[model samples]
Target: MSDQSLLRERWLPGVRELSFGGDYNPEQWPREVWAQDLDLMRRAGVNLVSIGIFSWGLLEPRPGEFDFGWLDEVIEGLHAAGIRVDLGTPTTVPPQWFWQQNPHVRPVMRDGTVLAPGSRGICCPSSPEYAEASLRITTQLAERYGKHPAVALWHVHNEYGAPVSECYCEVSAAAFRAWLQARYGTLDALNTAWGTTFWGQTYGDWSQVGAPAQSASMSNPAHRLDFARFSSDELLGCFTRERDVLHEMSPGVPVTTNFMATNCPSMDLWKWSREVDVVANDHYLTAADPRSQVGLALDADLTRSLADGRPWMLMEHSSSAVNWQPRNLAKRPGELARNSLSHLARGADAILFFQWRASRRGAEKFHSAMLPHAGENSRVFREVTELGATLWSLTDVLSSRVQAPVAILWDWESLWAQDLDWRPSVDLEPRRQVREYYERLWHDKVTVDFAHPTADLSRYAVVLAPASYLLTGEAAANLTAYVEAGGHLVVGPFSGVVDQDDAVHPGGWNGVLRDLLQVSVEEVLPLPENAGVTLTGGTRAGVWAEDLAPQDAETVLEYTDGPAAGRPAVTRRALGGGTATYVSTVLDHHALTAVLDPVLERAGVTIDRDLPWDLEIVSRHGADGSEYVFAINHAGAPVDLPVEGVDLLTGEPCTGSTKIPAGAVRVFRR
Candidate 1:
């Protein structure tokens, strides 16, 4: 077997976990709707349900009143019906009374203007009134539901980044000043850190340092970046508050909150992952086009990597095309199967559909649900049942499973820092780079874990941090230690450029890796969008390219024929027992693969030679010396698989060749 295949066989008995749940609101329907939905779930093979997601209006109908009668009914009802319940905190959209009485409960924008309140998550984190009320409610929740046998896991707030940025009110101003005082000690220190000396924008006192929530100077990436940081920390602080309450109330119940897949720039997932007991993410991909599909799937993989490859629940999905899109398209008969399989193929633990029954009214009313208004005898229901039965046959054969070796460090902190940095390319978008890096590795069948910069790195032989945009003091030390201990490292352009406070270092901000990279630059070129820089003429390509002054390094790819031509777009240097590579431009898929081939070779990782274009292959090495191989054919025509293996989904044996049916996923074991 090929080296890649060898590694593949070890990632087996893959238990794919799914959330077979959707906004379950029996309160909106009759009791009979519950039975029909439950039966549909049984057919859909859904093992879990995330009920009471938006039940605030029903749970508490009055001021200073507590009522969970409906939620309690659903939990007991589902448990007796044989479904696991993921309990949502309902901490997101608080009851109207709570906010009305304490007007300071809501967040105010930077100009001291209050946010228009109509939607959920309008509360300000810095508001003492909001914080106190939110904590009180969360603690009350943990106190009430801690020992319920029906409760499986604690679901914190839903999509915690609602209302986007927060708190520019007087309370927020006071809090920001306090936080700054704690961070920079005084206004002089803050001025020095932000280099206020440059634009003469230095603060005279801590009170003058306010949040950038809709600041007067709009489009301030620096202030926006800092606001983004404060927002992330603030949101995380909210999460931590609830989790701590849960810790005190029910230590055994693992805590988690479903994350919106596309909501990255606002929420720091690295910080969220650390607080979540089991990282949960909602994947909503309704696009029919190929690029969008690829992008969405790459996002799924990146989300999986975010929490270090621990199996995460597929929190929310539409059974059919969601109405939220401009052009709503329903899932074809087997399309749900394709969607569920795609999630499993990437790294999803559970398969679930959002909104168990269709809403009778509201914006989501038109959205597809399991039991549509037509009831259980629908085409969607039949397909749901068929998939559910098939999943039941597997019974978590891939359960109690974990991802193997490869680690990818994804840091939102670095992204924020880079965005806030006063210099260099304004185009170094962290989210774009993250998706690009994850997709490249995933296409090659590399089992990767999304790790924090401060996470332990010794387990994986190779670590890829595409945009290590924000490198903290201790985190930089951790990276240095990882390299010194002989693990290969990869960093691209715009990396090691800033610290957590959105400030550059005196000695070239590559921090710990600067000495190891051996290359330093006082100024780097920033290419514009649509500006294509060709490297090596024959083999390499990248956008927004940069040049480097190589020191103790070999130039791998040079921009052979552009205005900024002959400048190095790629460079490599030997460091300790491993190697460090820097790519100056973001390569298109083919170009990216071409560049990564050499780097992967250096790291002793290889992909199959004759893999088909529309076919995706993945390899995972289990911790207990087991290997599993998954080959998925995403094309119309059947292809003859080239490797030898046994059929894993079933105990059936397979030979040297196998035909992977179109849109089919085949798992094999050696």
Candidate 2:
């Protein structure tokens, strides 16, 4: 066992603390409101909850009937109130008598309609009767809560490719032609990697391959990027077939599922973060983006870089305003402890939420919870009982980690082949160009993570990419062996321009990092809708541009007015002692902080250049050589925060300058 004892037996088994509660339906109130929802979840400092996700029609009310008597009295009253469960597996809402006995296991749209089952991720992840009734209700909830003692953590299916990810059924077109004959083992290599001899749409059997369904015009950007990689590996084979039946009926519990990470752009969370066992997520607050806290610190540093930096799980969020946006905005008083201490300063050793009393009915009765509806005398249960007494005084940040010298690549099949549908700018959004370079390295407090461009970037000292439009030749030789072992890369616009089968890159436009970006692209000029451009150091740029020739690099910004006017709009090259650069357009954020402040001072990196673009900070450390930090502040007044010591949320002390008020959050401990 040791992957640190299976990550503390799947998320602190014998509690190292910090798991706060939420999502506890308690069969939508009744049995004396489950002892006043366990005395308002122990007066709001709840400790892990997520019970029976959307309770499969009151836990099987027919069809092989079963009912765990009100989930064994709400997991024996949340294990007599010391709380802790994260149990779920309600198979993301399946029971309308198993959708009226499998009405073709629902989900079909790619213009083929069908989707009807009353919401909550309606089935068909390549349905074989939804893989035998979602592994028989996940082997009857892992043989009834696999040795339950308030079952510490299983939470199997809740947010898998949300609201149905891909299912243009004919049983998902014969399971996407048996996942394209196990990934192109010939229909002439799936008609030459779906180029299909340019739209005559060559298939010659594999039952005329389908699922990029309903298309009279646009349906073969390599067959819609391999049906978005076979609908994200058939919803990660329905979450590893219920995470391998909750690891053979719960042999050491710890299963996990949740991960709407960049808000569900259909799974492929680096292949579902190697089939779970902790790496949770959920994040909300796009409440009309006034920089939703920089997309909640870029989804908590891409869910703690998909748990490679360990300490994951902020399982869900919203202790205020979140009833499916379009004008639902609340969390204003210290914005839910600065969005739960910005997901516990980017490593999240458990924070949980999505509920824990508040719903008086269904369809997420006004989403935000943590005992709200004026319950524990509300104000979101007094900032969730003061962020649960500041996460039970951070049990020394349980297995602390978050230390990033900057990294960013993040692939999801190069953002599903740069969100396929005629690229070259529909405002070429690769998640808004990696959230505008992670909100300019999170307003320069600079602590990022994200990797996966062929992993190991010898511990990042500057790496960027920004929106890698599918660059694969072994991630361009692991980024030209991380710029020939010196790092500092960058890239940006229409990056390495396509491979890994979306085609293109065969001598021309960044053919796999033209010799680690000595530059090439002689065409792609995008910008139009309300245009923009300027460059030659006056910066400005917009949507895109390219022309760029510089065969030996060094230009670093040129254009000077729209359609590649004077050409090269940013380059660099260097090589052996690290350098690359690139970026052809789309700059703004003070022109990407004046092209990353001299490449972060030629890769020495360290920033905090008198931080306070609404203060943020970060830190973490701890496997003995302690640290902690945090800060937060999200503006409206006071700031300062140079950081020194003590303050674990007001046990004060912190000299070396601290202050931090208006929309507060501190932490410290250094």
RMSD to truth, every model: 5.5, 18.4
Q: How close is every model to the real structure, measured as TM-score?
A: 0.88, 0.41
The candidate that achieves the highest TM-score relative to the unseen native structure: 1
| Residue 228 lDDT (model 1) | 71
Tens digits of lDDT, candidate 1, 623-659? 5565556676767788898767667666678877888
Q: Model 1 Cα displacement at 137 (Å)?
A: 4.2
User: Which portions of model 1 miss their true places by more than 4 Å?
Assistant: 1-19, 110-113, 135-144, 213-224, 286-289, 326-329, 345-347, 396-405, 420-427, 472-481, 507-514, 540-542, 619-628, 643-651
Question: lDDT per residue, candidate 2, 1-670, as tens digits?
Answer: 6443474444557777777877777777779878977886787678778888778677777765778888987888788888888788887788887778788778878888888888887777877776787787778878877888778788887888787788887888888888789887779988887678885888788887877877777778888888888888888888888887777777676787889888888777987887787788888888878878998898889888888888888888888978877799787776887888788888888888887777877767887788878778767788888888888887787778888988888888878887777676677777888898888878888898988899898888899987888888998899888988998888888887788888988878778888788788878888888688988767686877888788898887788777778787888988888888988788888888888889888999877667678788888998789898888888889977666789875687877886788788778777
TM-score for candidate 2:
0.41
Each model's C-alpha lDDT? 0.68, 0.81
